[model samples]
Target chain A: MSYLQLSLYSETLRLETNVQVILAADPAASPCLLLLHGASDNDTIWARWTSIERYANRYGISVVMPGAHLSAFADMRRGPAYETFLMRELPEFLHRHLGLPTARELNLIAGLSMGGYGALRLGLRHPERFSAIGCFSSGNLLVATGFIPGTSDPYGWISLVMGEDINNPALAGNPDFDLFEILAALHADAPLPRVYMACGRDDFLLNCSRMTAERLAAHPALPFYYEESHGAHDWNFWDRYVKHFLDWYTDTEKTLTETTTD
Target chain B: MANIIFHSLSPALHTQRRLRVILPDSRRNDTNLPWLLLLHGAGADGSRWLRMTRAEYYAEAKGIALVLPDGDNGYYTDMRHGYKYYTYLSEDVEADVLRNFPSLSRDPQRRYVAGFEIGGFGALKYALDFPDHFRAAGSFAGGLDPQSLDPDYCVLTFGSYKQAWQAENDLFNRLRTALTDDTRLPDLYISRREQDYLYTVPDRDFASDNAMTSGHTIKVSRFDFNSADPWSFADRSLAWFLDRICPDRAQLFTPPAAADCPDDCHTDCSDDSLADCPTGKPTKE
Candidate 1:
């Protein structure tokens, strides 16, 4: 993999930010995967916890990881315009700077936690741009009515993503703010991006993925791929399943390398 | 200008390398900007060009891309017992940089490389060996005779001072071979200060000797400044190279000019060996 640590000025964010791009053997021939990180992690986090470089090399795919800070991959009501950066500026920047192919067929997205929600938000909203979505252990997303999904106050911090009105941002009408709305509102004449949802059975945020997967499966137009096993809300689970997600995305016959690594 | 630090695992040198690139801020969409491969000398990392001189500003002013690579004390060579730095710098660096910025010019006429001490020799070797790849190269206060260099550095880098790498790194011999074989040599810019010790005091008159070879077409251009400070060579040479390559742009390589400085600005830099000056610290390059 030809790894590049890139720092460029973002017109949308109005600041300079870092992006990590790893290219497979030939970027001109590989599909571009927009891999996002969780709230506590930056662009360089995934490779540190997973053998993403070797995985990219073996699978013959290019991975682009961008730092979204604690933005939850959303253009916060009070924070930097990260949603604009990721949706509008990011693809254009990658296409111009790295000469990445910009056609919808060559583009895909996936993430873990906040990034997982980001993958669903960015990928589901624009079926014209992305062809596949992978969401892993997305958190605190109960329904479109109340996005802050939790039994108690343990997950209250997720409210910071939506400045005021954390309990109910009146997002049901928008259908673009929360994961369930986006999954529910996805409408296309043709099913383009296949959706993959996964979580650890022992993970605290397992219900989010389950509910979202259920909503996506009931959509009648979307192909749903869901999986769960023994694990917790940690990198080991993500490290193991990210490979499986890649296998399902590439339409490869499932291999038992997961058992070996786990 | 934008400073980009590119970190990569190099298979050629078998090490993790963090190389920097100075990309022009304007005319970025043109995609045909001239490229300059700048190598750092011994006793320095890649930042020597940035910390010691305003090379990036010069590059921006000239609308050229400056590629700065770390040429360790091994003199940018594929050392016998050390790393294959030359291969990494010349081959992998080119690929890595182009991979990152695919818009940079690939034309040989728009490509060049230069350096200060061991870096200068490295540039010379690069240009001579692969003239088809580079249109020009420059050496500032370096690559004189190789024997005039520190014995310890020479022995540690290349087995012996007298014999090892003598034929390979000898610029004079390589130039003769290029001329004899009609290899279509690149334009050369060689220079050294009059009060300099490593180059001017040696038996070779590198500038005049080069003048004799490239008179008709003005291929070998020499512009040795009047400063006595060896520390000032990289700054002056970097400006000269940029001005020579992109003459149309405003010349930002120089300040008010060395002539405008105090008479004793570089007076203490005439020591035969690297040493501390009466007025300042030791020169790193």
Candidate 2:
């Protein structure tokens, strides 16, 4: 695997940001996987903590890991347009410079914790761009309260991105920013990407993952596979399950192709 | 990977400059990590190394920070007609990087410099000019002899061909002086492609001169590749830097153990159970 650390100027964000990419030995014609890191972490976590290089080499896939620091992959009201950067700017840059595949079948998105939320949100929002989405121990989905209460202000950090009025029709209409409203509005004809959701039984975000799973289960037309095992929301669980998710994605692709041909 | 850019007031250039850095993952907290001042060739900026080569992977594995500062097509020199890129790199950029990244080693032994093409020339010049700051230097297909370059470039870079040939600007003359001086000299490593017109003969002469000199150590390696499909000189140069700075850290690039020789596989073949190979071959039973 060939690793490249890039400092790109995002026109959308109007600031320079970092991205770490692991290219397969033969990146030409290789399917690309966008692996996102959680909050407070940068792109290097995948390289440092996990054997992602070995996995990319084995699977013949290109992995693009970009750091979206503290932003929940949302176009923040106070900060950068991270959602636009990831969905629009980043992919364009990758395609132009690295020859990353643009076809939906040749691309995959997966993340852990905050990144997991980003992956599912982005994938669901842009179904035409991704064939599969994997989320592990996801956070920032279906909070009982619109805000985490502690200080006098009920609407704190979450409100900064989702805005003051959580019940706004525009917010409810967009699945990427509002999962709860989007889940309720899911219809039979709406395009749905294949989803792979996993969380450790003991993870602090287990309830969030379960809630996401329950929401998805409500819509029979949406295709998703949810799994929970004995582990926590740590690197160990993520490392093991990330491998499984890749394998499952590969297998699922083959099965879909086989079924389509039949 | 951390991307940082800071403003630097360079007395040499008489202007504020931006220095870009690519830092290794913070998780690798072994110690104050070694650093490489990677200079870009002409027509590129600080970010070129990351875009063109697998430098980040190699740097991450070797646990070194990469300091990439824009050379601004100035040939990384104290240009007479233009900017003082050498001083900017050796002084301004270095100070800025060391100050911002306190985790990076201040020891000269842990600091190195390297570049490609004209940047390669810059690396050697930095080492020779500031021997107290850099422990080692590497040049990959660099323009070693500025005098041999296009007359216009030499004029723009050094004011004239005569100045370009002078000891201050000419690497050959500087290298000769280093050999004669009793001062601590940095280890030099140079690699050139055989087909490269600018560096092939100059690199050979530099290597030959160093070999004849008593105390200085200069290692030279050559490769042959078509211009269309050039070899990754960045990877080779980085490996050379790591080998010189920290030999133990150099082991990261070592080839994996032979497939037949698994962790449990015994080389002695003394025990019967271990003697029989997976291929059903009989051994010492």
Kindly report which residue pairs in candidate 2 clash with one another.
none
Interface RMSD of 1: 18.0
**Candidate 2: docking tier:** incorrect
Reference-based lDDT, each prediction: 0.70, 0.70
Model 2 RMSD to the real structure? Answer: 19.5
Q: What is the TM-score of chain A, computed separately for every candidate?
A: 0.88, 0.85
Residue runs of model 2 more than 4 Å from their true location after superposition: A25-28, A144-147, A150-156, A165-176, A185-187, A252-262, B1-285
Residue lDDT tens for model 2, A1-262: 6889887767876555678898876665888898988764666677777777777776789999987655677786644678899989999999888878788888889999878988987787777788889999884454623233332222123444554433332333444566766555555575667889999998888887888888876677778899999898788888777777888887754211111110
- Residue B225 of candidate 1: its Cα lDDT? 47
Worst 10 residues of 1 chain A by lDDT: A148-157
**Model 1: lDDT of residue A55:** 78
